[model samples]
Target: MSCLTARTGRQRQRYEGHLRLVSGCIPYKFEKSVGGSNCSTEKDLLVLMISSPSRDDLVFPKGGWEDDETMSEAACREAWEEAGVKGVLGETPLGDWEFRSKSKQNSCSLQGGCRGFMFAMEVTEELDSWPEQANYGRKWLTIEEAYRACRYDWMREALKKFVTALPESRENDTIKELEERPLRPISEVEHQMPSQGCFGSHPSIQQLAA
Candidate 1:
């Protein structure tokens, strides 16, 4: 719920020894049906795009993953920081993409390349203003438009993979569920489940038997 709470003070120098790993979110929202159109069956997907601070290119929300947070957390944090949006992060990453960092001060400066983990984030809320609002501009575009507008080839590929994995109808359902509930991490949900056979011990199973 908190966006841009962490200070960007100084880039940590510790990652200078290894290849920089970044986490990012592909933020998406369901576009409402047109006034004249039937709402029952129509579902449109729109992806959020952010303008890069130093360039004219439009890119997804992404940043370096800190030592203290999980990859999902980092992706969610980046989405909030860069795009001023909050949502449920997907349990699995869409894929990894390799890119060369332009920042000379970071670890990628020496390595010349960085690995990015991309995940799907169903946008539930959008803030009026965000920390990087002055530096970045946000827009929502259709899948094809977003793909063509992407600044990096690797990112385009990631978008393609995410789209291919979830067709329009299924994606609509997923987005609806995320918006309806505050999703917990898959790990936490699994830990709370009873360790018994599917037909044993569970209340639902007992009711069915009765």
Candidate 2:
């Protein structure tokens, strides 16, 4: 069932030192042209972006990594609550970004610093109404428009990584590919984060907050 209410309060919010850890995704879907015709290329892929209630610019759905839920769960919940969409989240994150938040308690070493992890979601369903639908207006944009609409340097950079990581955007070498194992997952965060470790996805103590 879909949640009708958005979660609130920072009481259970998790923090690594002074920086708040946030999670979100670039929700995307494949489509044909406005007519019921098949897409010739991958150019028809669309990304969903939501309006920031406090700003004129659009932003991907994101929110706090509360103590109770896994980072991936938080990311998925934020997308559903804010943008009214649900989909499969990529195994690896698109990228991590440090940005400043307008909220006094969140930032990227500026005022209130925040460290955010973003993933690519292959959106499967969309709802007519969501928890934050009244505050966040959703729009579907092409990759080019999404890039131009980005309001922050980090957002743009993360978007670039997202594009690069897309399987459709890759070029293959046939001979080299023939020798490689197909089981290997394409992951960028793994090599760059040998020591940092991913924020665990499950198996938490499931602490209850009073």
Candidate 3:
């Protein structure tokens, strides 16, 4: 089935570059992370995570997949839009885990759909400044600390895998280290169902918080 492809110029550029490299795609979306720890005598690795204001529970920076957008493209957009950070997304997927919303009645799920893919990418650059999106609370914590901070076991597991696999630091935003995989077409049912439109129909983080 053909996937929905409607990203802007820059987004399209990023998506195309990664799609050229990675041939196939995976359906059944989940959450992913690429975390590391610099723990020692002084301080531990500080990674940022957020909690939904409505639910008031900790969550990693992640979101649903975009139509035809490669894993890297979706990861970067989720990080940027949710965390307000500027960095190159990693290509090597750390891990993928499944999760369900606390409420199946979530605005998006109620109106659109609920399927998503969880993928991780390396952060190439950290912007000196950025603005936090609406109703989101962010915090920096050690990898271990993040485990306690996150609300779900699956989220903690994803973070742990990322922490173990993450490199020392962000060095290059443009260089992609992972070899490309075959790109698979998104399922037709995914596009027609309300689950996929879940977020689009309800475009407020407030619902997440609520």
List the global CA lDDT of all models.
0.64, 0.69, 0.41
Query: Residue 78's C-alpha lDDT in candidate 2?
Result: 94
User: Against the true structure, whose TM-score is highest?
Assistant: 2
- State the lDDT of candidate 1 residue by residue for 22-75, as single tens digits: 888788877766554454645788888887766656788888877777777778
Collision count for each candidate, in order: 0, 7, 28
Alpha-carbon RMSD, each predicted model: 14.6, 12.5, 16.4
Where model 1 places Cα greater than 4 Å from the true spot, the runs are 1-6, 9-17, 35-41, 104-109, 169-210
TM-score of each: 0.70, 0.73, 0.51
Model 3 RMSD, rounded to 1 decimal: 16.4
Question: 1-210, model 3: which lDDT tens digit per residue?
Answer: 033222333333222222212111111111245445853333224566655656645566665455566555666655655554444333445555544545544454432323333444333343333333444555554444444555565665555555444444231221122112222221211111011011111111111100
lDDT for 68 in candidate 2 is 94
| Model 2 lDDT per residue over 122-179, tens place | 7888877778777888878766666657767677666666665666643223213422
Off by over 4 Å in 3: 1-43, 105-132, 167-210
Whose TM-score is higher: candidate 2's or candidate 3's?
2
Q: Pick the winner on TM-score between candidates 1 and 3.
A: 1
